[model samples]
Target chain A: MSLLRKGQQWGTFACVWHIFDATWQDPFRSAHLIKKYLMGLYKPIYHPLNQCGDHVIVINSKEIALRGDQWQKRVYFHHTGYHGGATWTLAWELHSKDPTMIMKKAIYSAMDGTLQRRFTMQRLHIFPDDNVPKEILENVSNQIKQLRPVPNRLHEIPQEERDKIPRLIQYPSDYQLK
Target chain B: MAALYRVLNYLGKNVVLTAQNRNISLSAVTRIKEIIQKKEGNTLTFEAVIKPDPYEGRFLKPKNGACAICSSGLDIKHTDVLILSQFVTSEGNILPRRITGLCETQQKRISSLILMAQYAGLMLRRSPKGGLLHPLQKRKWKKFNSYYDEKTIKARYK
Candidate 1:
């Protein structure tokens, strides 16, 4: 094979590392996108039996946002294999116990329940904050886009930018100013 | 003759007495003013000056008879704090339709969006302090981040 063709083959098969920011992102929705990278579904030569999956490192797992009242309404079930050992934990309670547990469980449940599921999960790394190990951080070459843009708080905006927005309504001449 | 002489003496002094009629009410007065007190020589003068509008000619106006929000055709979400803040008072209360000039449906929609933004903690500065806890300090699940879907708002106009 030509040298250029050999280089392209090596590039196609090489496993890459991707980074994702979970700040204000919906974990369930993000799981679907992360699953694609974890299983290497984007690869042109991907196969069910092939080991072409890439590694995904998620940062700010604690900041993952849920839609509506999911934090209070969603429940996580646990069983200790004993009589009356089954327990239900609310999403917020689970998050308080371990910040990364919700994010980890989200990605784990997103994939199919196969024998390789556990093995595939080993390639996923989740951090509660941005403090990733140097060795792992060195390998990340790409970043996965967030599902939704993070909203800005009104108090956090600077005074100059706040002054620039056009006024939509003018108070009546006789209206009292609060 | 003595009573006429007393009246002539009072008129000769050139003193003018004026009684200004004012209505007293429990509600706040709409006329906002800045009171300025000036002392010159031996006389003190008090003046109530009307405050000027900061956004005089720059107000967003719709060309047609439609409301500004409807005419602009901007798909406003709860995250758009800049636009949403315009429809609220300094205390974060939604302005009345008479002052906002928004249609009934648009008024209802904007109010709902403001509520969602408050729950999400995007417009905490404008929120009124009624409860014991501060608006910035949320408890339990309320502290966490949450978003809303605009379609979930039930502002149906028949």
Candidate 2:
């Protein structure tokens, strides 16, 4: 029941601008959760084309949550064209080697081929520690500026976002059709 | 009629060249002449301008470097603005024609140029920072990893 509650809460997450240092959760699992939250797949108004997602930064990657006897049972395998060059490593070993890589790979996998997916994956700035650089926070808005929250039908802007000058859209001049 | 069409076409291209760069649209003029020839039962005499395009003199200066975008514009003035404006994005997508406001003719040329740059590895193919994820990530709960789905599995297995 507790697990279900946490999962439910995670499903409707608002954009939290904080560092992820809560626990030693498996970044692999946490990355998927992060991807789901930021990709709009879990949102009420999820549209495949609509730009809807939040910027997520996972800091202190060295510590993330994990479950099961995955450290032993889980083995990552990769191949090299040369025979007998196949490489394998356990999750426990990889986590220590580079915790940042694990989450980076997982979140990357979740995003897939969407423009928003690209934005989400790209927006995910990871650091080994809890402190985010000042430059990153400043540049966040420019990163996700293209993805519109809602489709502009009349191309009207709400009172808040009207400060940015958008290209004026107009109906064809009366002389055009004639 | 064919001659008149060629004359009018050359006149038009020359006018554009005169104002901008030395790009005389030699190909366009050739195309117009060819088009006129293709017309059956042609009644007009054809005339090709033997004189050099006037725009070339203003835009292209052998003593002074010519503007790549406009040969006719003095000192190739607009090249810097044009080149900077057309810089490719990190992900390989060439900026599209609409926002750039380039005419169809110039747009086509720019597209070809961008493609060459990308192919030569001088430019990146505007791709997202992280690559696409295979479908198996979402479907991991199902215990099978795959790029294909049920429809594909059914087709292949059957």
Q: Looking at model 2 chain B, which ten-residue stretch has the lowest summed lDDT?
A: B141-150
> Any residue pairs clashing in model 1, and if so which?
none
After superposition, the stretches of candidate 1 with alpha carbons farther than 4 Å from their true spots are A1-8, B1-49, B125-135, B156-158
Error of 2 at B76 (Å): 80
Q: Chain A vs. true chain A, TM-score per candidate?
A: 0.95, 0.54
Please provide, for model 2 over A1-178, each residue's C-alpha lDDT reduced to its tens digit, 9 standing for 90 to 100.
Answer: 6999787666545453423442445555566667765666666767777666666667666544343345555677778879898999876567667767766877787567755666667656787667778866654432221111111211133534433322211111111110
Instruction: Encode model 2's per-residue lDDT on B84-127: one tens digit a residue.
Output: 22334333455555444444544555565554333222233433
Please give the interface root mean square deviation for model 1, in Å: 3.0
What's the i-RMS of each model? 3.0, 18.2
Q: Give the Cα-based TM-score of candidate 2 against the true structure.
A: 0.33
lDDT of 2: 0.46
lDDT of 1 by residue, A1-178 (tens): 9999898788669898999999999999999999999998998879888999999999999888889999999999999999999999999999988999999999999999998889889999999999999999999989999989988988889989988888888877766555
